[model samples]
Target: MEKYLMKSKAMHYVFVIIGTILMAVSINLVYEPLGMVTGGITGLAIVIKELTGFIIKGGIPLWVTNIILNIPLIICAVYILGKKLLLHTLFATLCLSAALALVPSVNILPEDYLLAAVFGGALGGVGLGMIFVASASTGGTDLLAMLIHRFKPYYSIPRILIVIDGFVVAVGAMVFGISKTLYAIIAVYITTKVSDGILEGLKFAKMAYVISDSYDEIAKAIMEKLERGVTGVYAKGMYSDKDKKMLFCVVSKKEIVDLTELVSEIDPKAFIIVSDVREVMGEGFIEYKQ
Candidate 1:
């Protein structure tokens, strides 16, 4: 238990570090320089700062506002995702906020708005992806999405997030004018794309389901040549009502082409379906059981 706890803590720190670096790069190099508002607490803060110019006395500074907004989200995470997720998320959020406040003192990128938007969005996405991999979040609207998901599991979290973010962007347009608001939308889109890319890269796995006449040979080849365990599932063809031996195995993307070629050589008419799995956990995968 002690060993596991230490390992978990170490993993959390690694995620926090990656999140911090990405957030810092996005804020300093892209979003702030370009005056592009994103779809989170940070975006809201940017608009507020641009409109008020730091003159809102007694109200929270953008930095403080960020911390405050995440509080409820963290609480929600504790309930939805569990205590371990909450702690890692808190660590990531604090570190991100601190990086934003501190890193600006040293300008690190060009002032071109387009460049800023593209790179900043990419950086922010990667950061968010790292946080997600750790089963944590940087809070904000994500917490709200999770809370909603907890009570209504059928509701799409992504759609909920988009609606909330859209509202926020509308507010930004009203406050920061149409031009800045449009740029913010662009940044948000870029951020989402980059985040997706990062997540995809980090958790790339292939799920292959094969049905062929040469089931035994194919299974043997996969197990021995590929050094991967295969599950021989008893399956029935829906249309034909014929019994079949279905071979299921998860492997890396690098092996997909080779696996396909090998299957083709053995059985030219084999039916193979390949799906991209975001994450896998267990022996010969992510080691979740341990």
Candidate 2:
């Protein structure tokens, strides 16, 4: 048991290391060269590095700037987010900083700042996703998001975070240009989307809950037309005080309309409910793996 636990932790650390390095490469190769600040402490670090380049010759390195900014946030996280998260956050931060130092800045794009923004944001998003899935974060504005989440649990941290990151990106607009600013916005949007996709996984499906008097007909129609399995859950109507077959089926979004039509044709007032399912693994969908 102890050996297994150790192995798990080791794998997690490896993943975080890889993720941080990929993120650093994206920053150095894409963001820095294009001067596209897509938000986050890393973005700010780039801005600072450029602004202070005259003072210290080459300027304060991104790794140093990143660590300096993350210090207070890390401390705040330890108090608010707990020690486990803080430990992982610290590891992620350190790994990211080391990566930034090791990975040299290279110009991948010639004149296409748009390409840089897109690629940089996508690569960074993937790295961030891997870190997040491992229960760690590349500390920066992430700490601020967590801090805000702690204060107001009701408000969505990610959405609020967009507003926060917007300011940072706006600063980039001022320093960089209107064109770069637009690309930065695009980068940030794509980054969030790709990160969300990674965190949620790729499995997408729809769930339909149907309560109808002609349960047998509806079930048969769904099986024949939709070619999907239907699970009949025994349920009782509240007002009617009568037992019935509450059918349930998981189908693709494309098939939803067909299934709904079948249900409606059978019984218009069937008390049907449909909902979006983010992930599903079963006989019909992605195979269960362990």
Candidate 3:
């Protein structure tokens, strides 16, 4: 058990590092050059960078703004909540700051807003996905969300984050203009979709509910041929007023065709409902892990 925990911790940090690099690259190389602000502390930093460019040469660096902004937030959070709760967040945030500082800025993509938004969002999404999978966050507005939720327990963290990030985006619109802001919104949308895909797409499966008089035979064939398990659910047919066994099974997308065919072959009148499953765990799927 101890060894497993140690390995898990190591893997978590590894994921954080890789995710930080992707996120920083997206910000510095793609979003910064195009003046796209998607939201979060980095977005605010971009706005500040542009504003300060009037006075300071090249304005403030992203890492500088990130560190300065996060420090006070981190200190307040620690003071109000506790250190233990923010340890992982601190680590991830520091890694991101380091990455932003070290990763050289370059125009890797064309100056096209659409292209920048798509690729930037893709990189940020994958980075966020991995960071979330590691059970950590890059702090910034995430920490702000936590603090707000702590004070106002009635409001959820995610809702608070939306409000806060939206405010940031609105402010960014003021700085970057409506056209760039529109592209930023598109980038944000793509980021959300890709991140959600990373989190749930890989584990997606198909679920089927089979109802027929020959449920037993269908279950047997599914288990024997498909090498999958089926559950007999006690169901009552409302129209017929008969107690029947409904077969419940889950299989990969590739195997759903075979499962339906096998059911149709055995019982022509079988009422089968197939649905998409976002995630499945257990035998023949992802193993349960601590």
Instruction: Give me the overall lDDT of model 3.
Output: 0.84
Considering lDDT, where higher is better, how would the candidates rank from best to worst? 3, 2, 1
Clash pairs, model 1 backbone: none
lDDT of 1 by residue, 140-227 (tens): 8766765776688776444456667888888877876678667667767776666555544455689999999799999999988998
What are the Cα lDDT values of the candidates?
Answer: 0.72, 0.84, 0.84
- By summed lDDT, the worst window of 10 consecutive residues in model 1 runs over 1-10
TM-score of each model, in listed order: 0.76, 0.80, 0.89
How high is the lDDT of residue 44 in model 1?
A: 77
Q: Choose 1 or 3, whichever is better by lDDT.
A: 3
Taking the tens digit of each residue's C-alpha lDDT, what string does model 3 give over 13-108?
898899899999999999888888888899999999999998999999998898888887888788877877578788989999999999988878
Which residue pairs clash in candidate 3? none
Clashes of each: 0, 0, 0
lDDT of 2 by residue, 9-76 (tens): 77779878988988998899998878888888999998998899999987889999999999988987
Let me know the TM-score candidate 1 reaches against the reference structure: 0.76
- Where does model 2 exceed 4 Å of error? 1-7, 151-157, 209-214, 221-229, 232-246, 252-274, 281-290
Of the two candidates 1 and 3, the one with more favorable TM-score, higher being better, is 3
Which TM-score value belongs to model 2?
0.80
